[model samples]
Target: MIRTLDGKEEGFPSPLIQIRRQQSHLENWLENHKFPRIPCQSFVVISSPSTIIKAPKSLKSQILHSANIPYKLGVLEKKFKEQLLTKPTLKKLSKTLMEKHTEEDVDLFAKYNISKNDILTGVQCPGCGQFPAKRTQGFWRCSFCKHKAKDAHLRTLEEYKYLFGNKISNQQLRSFLHISSRTSATKFFSTLNYVHEGRTKDRVYFIP
Candidate 1:
């Protein structure tokens, strides 16, 4: 089951192709594990009822609208009853699949040679989705919509954490957030309740 957003149809993969690829991968994994090559099915459920799908007739059954899911699921349940594995067999397969897997972290910023200046920084407007919402009177106000938000900087900090790591100093926070005051940044970090190390200017906080 996959849920897709409205207005993002271009980003979505063809359900038929994704289903075939997934089924092929699953079959290969089952074969490698000396397990039965069980049949696999895929469903792409769009949340918007008005969203149109230009799928071929063969793929139409696999693409569902969110509103019709309950009835569709009820119909699919009757078909899959005979295909479910036994509880004991399922437990064995689960145990086998629980083996640890490790993947190396890839820094796309370094890999693509992206400079810090290339990234946009600032509290974004929740109202109009505009950047650099001005800090004024204990709130971040959007320049475009004049919308005010008290915790808009937190969202900006989240973006910073995703681009960089969770750890950030007061100076780094101010730089990334486009805040001028060091005292203001410290106060913001205090409100987050993150763990801190070192003292005074050397302090570094970790966002949880």
Candidate 2:
């Protein structure tokens, strides 16, 4: 149920080209994605009364405007109700889709003009807010407050993943966490439950 908020719909076709593109994308994705057998339909919805939208003769019946939506969807609901899957199958299918939904290789550093220099280095003590929380003997030692938190590094890693990509490699974890040792980076990743892949140097981890 998507409706364009723009008031000027003067010259556009009923189910606009934009609407058709969306429909095509959904149809193609449904037919080609991992679960290609999932059933779905696309509709163009507009609610304005004065908007002169004229679908080509072939597609007029497919467009849904305010006046005919209830009757059309009511009829559709009765037909689709019988096709609902069992709970277990539906849940497993949803879980698979969610696990595979992570977008790969999105470089936020380039997208929003961010760089290593822009991020504030050092972990602030979770106990007492203070910068330059150095990694000392496998613990984040905040010199200002003399507070040590074993999990402070995890907070920084979480933030880095949030701002960048959901997936991370040893190199990315090292560079983002500002750790020099590969063993130290491995220690950080050990605490997370990730779908691991590849051999030693080429391994990547992503939450599923």
Top model by TM-score, which number? Answer: 1
Per-residue lDDT tens digits for candidate 2, residues 1-208, read: 2335676324434455766787777667655654435446566666877656555777766766788888888977987776546788678777866876875676777888878679876566898887768777878887788899887876776776677656889988777666788998788778766788899989998844
Instruction: Please report the TM-score between candidate 1 and the true structure.
Output: 0.67
Give, for candidate 1, the lowest lDDT window spanning 10 residues: 1-10
Name the runs in model 2 displaced over 4 angstroms: 1-113
Please provide, for model 1 over 1-208, each residue's C-alpha lDDT reduced to its tens digit, 9 standing for 90 to 100: 2336585433545666777787788788878988876766677788877777776798788888998888897987888778557888888888887762454577869989998779888888998999889888788898899899998877888888877888999999888877789998888777788999999879999977
Give candidates' CA RMSD values in order: 5.8, 9.6
Q: Which window of 10 residues has the lowest lDDT sum in candidate 2?
A: 7-16
TM-score of each: 0.67, 0.43
